[model samples]
Target: MEKRNQSAITEFLLLGFGDLHNFKILVFTLFLIVHIMALTANVLVIVLVGVTRSLHSPMYFFLSQLSLSELLFTSDIVPNMLWLILVGGGRVSVARCIAQFHILCIPSAAQCLLLAAMSFDRHIAICRPLHYATMMTVTRQLQVVTSCWLLGVILALFLYTFLRKLQFCDLNTIDHFYCDVAPLLQLSCSSTCTVELAVAMVTYPLLLSPFIFIIVTYICIIRTILKIPSSTGRHKAFSTCSSHLIIVCTYYGTLTFIYLFPPTDNSIELHKGLSVLYTLVTPLFNPLIYSLRNQEIRAAIFNYIQSFKKWKAEK
Candidate 1:
């Protein structure tokens, strides 16, 4: 039987943009450019936040780590994606696919928790300013960050164990650009009801829980901002929170669209597009949003640029 032969399959072919034969070169070039920009921007944020002492608050600290998560998240998939496009086809061993999936899940889950933690930081900073120093101390920041990563890893491993038990048949073509859960599940020979249930159970905690936490934190922050007597004070408070809000919306919106919707043949393309939005576009835009919209980040970047120029002139 066909099911018996499934065990011999060693790899899966990733049909990454293969349908765009006419625009193959164009697609490859565009993705390559954006991937480079995303990497540069995230790395810059990480370095600037670490070296710039003036930017050393719990808020910036979370932003830096978020950027780091984004960097690792994109790196887990993008390089392989770009290479596939260059070669005009992509082949990934089962082991490599599983590794990519695990690596991808870890960062994705961490970012969700990290975003929630950032929202909490903002809430404490604005809603409870008197207690901010005691509540969000350096030790507390470390604990929050550690918890984010540890929770992410634990959830990822938990889901991964269940996923490995599913039987993958001879169908080796993944319709997406990366080795993602939906596409991988589609290739399985076994009944996917249990896998889907496991996925939902795992994802709900990582996705919805953080999303709700963010909404609650932001609501509290907005209320606190509105309570300020002066219009100028309210504006200042809202401005501080706006950049993060934009990122949270974009990241979670596209992600929720992909995860919440069941993937069908008609909707696979849409899923890929939405995946690109969060995985690539969001990371690319995070640095731009923070740098251009936040006065402090802009100042730090300008000062760093000036120092670089001065060093070059002295050389």
Candidate 2:
């Protein structure tokens, strides 16, 4: 009898919605436009925060950090994605897959934690206005920022370690646009029970804790709003929270659907589209949705333009 040989697989192909027949160019062009917008929006927020001295408070400080993280978050997915579509390529090396997974996971988990921290800031600012200054000092801000990223790093590593240990036998196609863990698990050769249970045990609390705090913060915020004698004051308070609420909902709603519910084929297809909204579109819109509509930001823009003109004339 001839000796039989078995070889270990070194890479996996990402099926990525499995190539639309003729929509490659159209999709690439559309994504390019969105990519440009995403970069521009995120960069604008970062730059504005850098140039403005008055925006040095905790809120803007966190916003700037969120903008930076969002920029990273989108960069990790969009470029490689556009290339895959444009070239009609879906192949990715095992090493590259793990690397991409790591980069995307870190910033995402960090932002989730950062958003939670921001909610706490809101709670302190609104609920205990007098103590807000002392509670959210620069030292506390640094501590919170450090804790957010460190905690994220620890949690993401826990998931990634198990995910990387998964053995792949035959399947390589990913149903979604990006390398998400659940869809990847469907391709694993290992008993995914351990991974699934570990994942849920770890991730459920990470997702829920922030949402719980956000709920509590908003409850307090609404109470404070109601206490205001003037209707205008109440409207303004509601408006202030509204933009953040829109962003939080858009981000978390799609994410919950992806992770909490089981991934049916239909839901997988739905998730691909919706993931674009949450991962790429929502982050870009955050600065715009929250700040562009604000009168203060509008006034700042006007003042910036005037200052630029005056400096040009003086020169």
Per-residue CA lDDT of model 1 for 96-192, tens digit only, reads: 7877888888888999999999999999999899999999999999999999899889988987887777677678898877888887787777777
Task: Compute the lDDT of residue 166 as modeled in candidate 2.
Answer: 73
Count steric clashes of candidate 2. Answer: 0
Q: 213 in model 1: Cα distance from truth in Å?
A: 1.1
Global lDDT scores for all candidate models: 0.86, 0.78
* Candidate 2 global CA lDDT score: 0.78
Error of 1 at 295 (Å): 0.8
Q: Flag regions of model 2 displaced more than 4 Å.
A: 1-7, 310-315
- In lDDT terms, how accurate is model 1? 0.86
Q: Identify the candidate with maximal lDDT.
A: 1
